[model samples]
Target: MKRLTITTLLAVAILSGCSSTEEVVPDVPPAELYVTAQQALQSGSWTTAIERLETLDSRYPFGAYSEQVQLDLIYAYYKNDDLALGEATIARFNRLNPAHEKSDWVLYMRGLTQMAQDRSFMHDIFSIDRHDRDPEPARKAFRDFKRLLDRYPNSQYAADAKARMIFIKNRLADYDLATVDFYIRREAWIAAINRSQQIQKLYPDTQAARKSLPLMLTAYEKLGLQEPIENTKKLIALNPVN
Candidate 1:
């Protein structure tokens, strides 16, 4: 009897422990979830906001806040440093709402996202030179911002978009200059001259154009290309030296 009684107690304890160990998920309603997410965002609790927003999206795909939640999710993703996810979310939004009246806002945000990514943490924080780094993100951001400007010239976001576009363009010019430098270093004078000329043509008003003239002159002189050397000198004369 004693052994049987002890066995029963053990079984009861095991059952009690199992119950205590079970996970309890909150059964928040979609509307309440969205409210919670908004609260989390206001509090700067990005992780909590992401969780609530994602839960709301999953639980109520067609809820009243569906579109708004998706939009907010992009900002949350960006804030959380999940750039890839943010971009993917933007793509989904664009695909779903191609004619959205607020598409300029989306384009602005997309441009900002790409601009943020183009910024290199290593270069920014560590003081490393990113002139030779990949310029694709900057290029993409420039295009997005340009599109926003073309589509909505008076948009409230246009000023900021234009500012970012300028920065990206300069960075792109620097990237071209970096490539020209690389060719110059390799003693590939003809390649350097050709690339420098292209930079001058493609980025006429850029600092790259200013720098490319000197580079082209050097490359032409190196190769005894007198005609091109004289032409490069004339181009350099167009920019008055400070």
Candidate 2:
């Protein structure tokens, strides 16, 4: 009977221990998870960090750390080189928290992400190892930089974005001039003139248009197009020094 009583007590103790273990398995709060994610990011485990951060954002959308996690997840995506995802996350953050303290950072990151995505195409043609003529990516980077400058003129990123914008605009004007020159070589006066007109209208401040106007006027004279000659004369009158 004493053995039976002892076994009963042992079972009760075991049950009590199991209950206490279950109760002691604490719920990890969102802030703790965010800290873990930050640690993972700092350690360069970007994928794991993203997973943890995404979980924190998803499971604790209303938690105190929710907004911060939303912003950090954009960084996580960028660190992982998932630019499309990063951009989408930034758009979501902007739409949801337009006046968030770090909104400027979000805008800056979006522009940076676009610039990174197009870095390869922004290089000079002589520097390119491949023969592909795709300039669309560079064009996109320019647009992104311009958007940042226009939207957040006083942002911390404004100066850098402006610099990049100038570089991209110059490159784009160069590309347009090259296209016009190619048409000129082929005796495609109309195409050449149209391209020059576009550069003058779209990028009036660019050196390309300033330099191309004289050539375009000569092309119009060669083509015997009276209207174009008159238009070229008008353009020269408007942009007198160029």
Candidate 3:
């Protein structure tokens, strides 16, 4: 009786271990999963949409809805504010479907995602200068949008992309001006002058260009450089202050 009781306990332990290894949730149908994800997305339940979409992607890697699922995942990741994941998803899509009929849209979305990532609560809501933060995302967004426009000039998103690119350009120029200002404050006259001149050369017709001329003039005056001082005055005379 003692031997039989020990054997029963061992058998029960083995069955419990097996049960633990089994999947708790059954596989959901691909169509059903996609629909549920779509519903969640429409309702602004981004996290739930991500989970459902990811499940569909993993389970139906070669299923009928694979392509759309990948695109939806990118959107879900973006809306969920998972910038890194969204970037990865779009990169994967680009790699897999470089020749996709809707490639233009994908490029537009990628640029949009980068722009969104660059947005900061401190900069937007609190009115902090964007120049105080990292400029990588905005620069990347500019490049992406440029690529889209170059490749698909007639794309439906071209006009909006161009507008965003202009905004990013101004923001980048402002960042450069901030650096120039920092140099000026430190009494690094030459560095400040060079940076100011660079902004004017690189971002012509921008407000930064208009602003940089005065900064360069200040730096030249500090250094007692007569030639550059006169040159900057001429530039200021040529350009209208906005």
Single out the weakest 10-residue window by summed lDDT for candidate 3: 17-26
Which parts of model 2 are misplaced by more than 4 Å? 1-28, 119-144, 204-207, 210-218, 221-242
Residue-wise C-alpha lDDT for candidate 3, range 1-242, written one tens digit per residue = 98798678768867975774322324777878788889999999887788888888788788898889889888888877787898898899889888999899889889989998787643554466567577899999999999999999999999999999999999889988889888989999889988988888889979988988888899999989899789889999999677
Best by lDDT: 3
The backbone clash count of each candidate, in order, is 0, 0, 0
Give the CA lDDT, 0 to 100, for residue 20 in model 1.
47
Candidate 1: residue 107 lDDT (0-100): 91
Write one digit per residue (lDDT tens) for candidate 2, span 1-242: 98798678768867875773211212587767778888988898877778888888778888898788878889889877788889898888888897887776786788677766654422432256322245576677677667777877888888988888787677777778888888888988888888998988888898888867877998999988889789878877777653
Between 2 and 3, whose TM-score is larger? 3
Ranking by lDDT: 3, 1, 2
User: Each prediction's TM-score against the native?
Assistant: 0.84, 0.65, 0.85
lDDT of 1 by residue, 84-189 (tens): 9899999999999898888898899888899878866446644776777898888889999999999999999999998887778778888988999999999899
Output the number of the TM-score-best candidate: 3
Off by over 4 Å in 3: 1-26, 121-125
Give Cα distance to truth, residue 223, candidate 2, Å: 2.0
In model 3, how large is the Cα lDDT of residue 119? 78
